[model samples]
Target: MIILMGIRDDEQVQRLISLDSKSSLADVVTICRSYEAAKCATSAIRAPPDQLRAVSAYKKGKKNKGHEKNLSTKPSPTTATFCKCCAKQHEPIACPATQSICTSCGRQGHWARTVQCPANQAQCLFCGHVGHYDKCCKTKKKDGRQSGSSGNSSAPNNNKHQDTRINSCRHLGSAAPTATKTPQPLNVLVSYGEATFHLLMLPDTGADVTVIGKRHLEILGIPQSSLQPPACTTTLTADGSTMAPALGIFKATLNLGKRSCPARILVHEGVQTPLLSYGHYKAIWL
Candidate 1:
């Protein structure tokens, strides 16, 4: 009973209990010795080929003192390792694998892990994926726009409202004539700490910074007092005309698909349409 209680394997315990009932202690000792011998034989047959080679080399090196140092310095052929410059192990001077090249900018001299990639900086604020922005995400595609419509405006049927509205800043570059057709608006989900709301914004590739209407503070459940002073007093309108000076600057986070990114929004009372600038757009979708 004492021996059976100590035995962990069910088969071994049951066999020993049955044998004890039929035989004596001498028979149990013989059976244990046979099981240990069979286990040793099985292990010897299943030994790794690299381990066998290493053992043979170690034995040969022991016969000669000079070969001992050479064998110790050289790594085994089948051993797995992580290289500093590449994915696979190679000579110190040159890497045999192409993983040394940067996957982001296509540059050499460092791996993507060592050096920061442009794609990493441009990761989607939504969805948290690389190589694409939140605007390009398929899962959050319908969240922004519906089919066959330019955009859903916050204020409907307001003819005075322009699709691309700006503030008092000067328009960048010379006023070149553009098409009369209005550009499509991008619906962005913005969050300010605990407050989350959707804003209809124009994807203005020509604009320098993102700007939003001051009225959005009401929807965000944040007072205008929480806003900071604007970095620049003046802002530009879509038609190159100047309106009112910026009210203030509000730092908030924008969530699209699955990712969220911090954004600096220039809040203005005169802004009817939120403008998503070129720099933020490049970092997101470009």
Candidate 2:
């Protein structure tokens, strides 16, 4: 009861209450750490503009205390606008660091620390092209028909359920899609162990498990051989076809805006795009 009362957060309290006889103190500590880590990783504490300016002014005054410097004649730091890009006082958009190269993706137009890199600006996982992600890649099909709306459009659908190992092709259709409406990819920033990725994922309510491609694992700097086997041995796809036996599975924290959810991600070979499961969507958004 004291532990329950101490937890001010409704979510934290609810999680603790849900545990049964199997739960231990370690579970409680893990829950607390997850919330604390999420809060620290996602939030930025900053002083108000006025308070920041006042501190700047105080520092400037202290630096020229002995000298006869005309403090009033100079433009006051308290009234100046702070520029995050170049760490100078100037207009927000008029940053001199705009011309500098971004260390994140090696782009030359923006500062990586101050701005979010555009998804289209990154390399596409499927086509090995720039200006788009694998989710938006339109690769040609084997039957001279365009692989329309198929998640793994780059790879040709051969084998035809004959392979011994499980293979999951979520939307491998032979016909071209006639619908003009396109599915918007969900942009998520995910962090695993220590690596972080700016990903464009497809929100799949159909998939029971969140899936990440082998290429994505490589990009995250995680080796394919290092992951653990999934709880389920055989996996089935949306089309009722057996999914290729998973390469492995790993737990990662997915961040969307200010919300974060821990998800068990399955790694599969030949998958181009990442699939965000419905359960994870509810955990983060609802």
Candidate 3:
């Protein structure tokens, strides 16, 4: 039988001998020492092959090639022709110039549908007087002779007109108007013993506690407490992983506008910003 000996000073060798009573020369066929096994392992690791040489050559080839160029570039500026009447540069579809004459006022700049005759105080469009369009007419049905009474009767009321205007003004095709409460900015104040600090009110209802950074705490001359307990809870970040919480709470006074509230300031170990968490805001203000 083959025997392996791991010698480590006198104590280890004695311990190994005690494990087996058959350590005698008559029982052993071959004995392999630890030093011999280590030398064989070292020699195998140092030896290089064809695959390693090929990999080194490929890396050198990549280094010789330059970096790749970006595919994106800035867009060119757009130019447009100006309209003769409006004097504005736009496409033909967007030009406001009109050719139809106003029947009531005898004008050529606008269509008959929008002609308001200032001479007789008559709207040619609604009165069907021929020169102006129907939209610019200001005459009531009772005061003047109604030429297009039938068309006026079929027109929409004021409420429907307002609704049409609102719908046309909307940019998103199918979005419903949703009511949202606007977030108000916060007022911040820091106090340590005799020293005082004034800060903005940052109301964040999503956070677990009120927090101040290390820089602010050090500036206020606040000493580190030895009795503080280590944070046990973990927080999940936007990157989809959990990190150990390095947060702690300290006592402080926060002035919110005209009123002042006693707040428990939470200190995040590596944070640089002074933030009031949603939990603290809801507890104090809301």
Candidate 4:
């Protein structure tokens, strides 16, 4: 005589009632609630097998199998002879005839030549060429061979062709060497609040403002919040006219090796050049 009320699955409920008519309806309801809770707990405890298979399949698809194969099969570039002074990828311009000391190693008897380090089998760090070490690489050497200077017809004709090729490489500009002077070190004095400090000055014409190192900032007692503009600005260096942005300005005192001077500070996230710029030089003059 037990009646199960409000059961959605009437057939299952009826079957249960029929099996145990002596049981109270409340007891049936409790059994049903317990069954539902057990089913939910089982589901929460374990993921479906199909879901695990799908995740494995996705991971397999994302793997770079082809790239790995290509990397394993590819050959590395051939090592070239490197110059130590110019760090160029060619024969040393300073031959034995010149008898120049290696600008890189500062050793006697050999002229600037490819970075072939007789002492080390390892490649030159500067030029990535085998047969030389970084101390023997001269990749930075300027080209002294003048095309028109030879006064030979072949030389002039070759120069014209080279100029044409260079011009074509640029979209709207003529071909010209954009070389800049190398950077040199200068002395600087930094003051944070009442504390005075000394540091190496690196002038960067590429920089619109001056910068102070993190250690200098801390020593000067300048708070981070005191800096203006919250973010750095982009700038270039006089050497090679390299471009970079600066973070912002800070209030600090700068002394060029000789005397202490009041100056505005520009902060940068990283060091690019060791050169000093006109802004810094002018500050020194003042």
Per residue, candidate 3 scores C-alpha lDDT tens digits across 241-272 of 66456545667777655656677775657766
- The best candidate in terms of lDDT: 2
Candidate 2, residue 215: CA error in Å? 0.7
Model 3 root mean square deviation, Cα atoms? 29.4
After superposition, which runs of candidate 1 have C-alpha atoms over 4 Å from their true positions?
1-183, 238-240
Separately for all candidates shown, the number of backbone clashes (residues 3 or more apart, or on different chains) is 8, 7, 23, 37
**What are the RMSD figures for all models against the true structure?**
19.8, 33.0, 29.4, 21.2
Instruction: Write the number of the candidate with greater TM-score, choosing between 1 and 4.
Output: 1
Give lDDT tens digits, candidate 4, residues 1-286.
6555676766556657666557786877778888778868878559788877888888887676767888899998766665553455654554442455654455665444444323233333233343433445454231123434444568668778678544543421211123223345666666667777666776543344666555555555667677777354345543336454555576666676575556666666665433334455545632
lDDT of candidate 1 over 123-238, digit per residue (tens)? 33333334433444443454334321434445553332333222211221223223122346766788887778888777665577798777666766778888888765456564
Tens digits of per-residue lDDT for model 2 on 1-286?
Answer: 2244577888878878888857777887888899999877655345467877888899988888835566556775566576655557776667787888655445566555443444323433233343433444454222224223343433444333223113212133311122122335778889987878888898664456899899988888888778988776788875568998888888889998999999889998989989887677556643
Q: How much lDDT does each candidate structure score?
A: 0.61, 0.65, 0.51, 0.54
* CA shift of 237, model 3, Å: 4.4
Q: In angstroms, how far off is 54's CA in candidate 4?
A: 99
Off by over 4 Å in 3: 1-185, 225-227, 237-244
lDDT value, candidate 1, whole model: 0.61
Question: Each model's TM-score, in the order given?
Answer: 0.37, 0.37, 0.31, 0.31
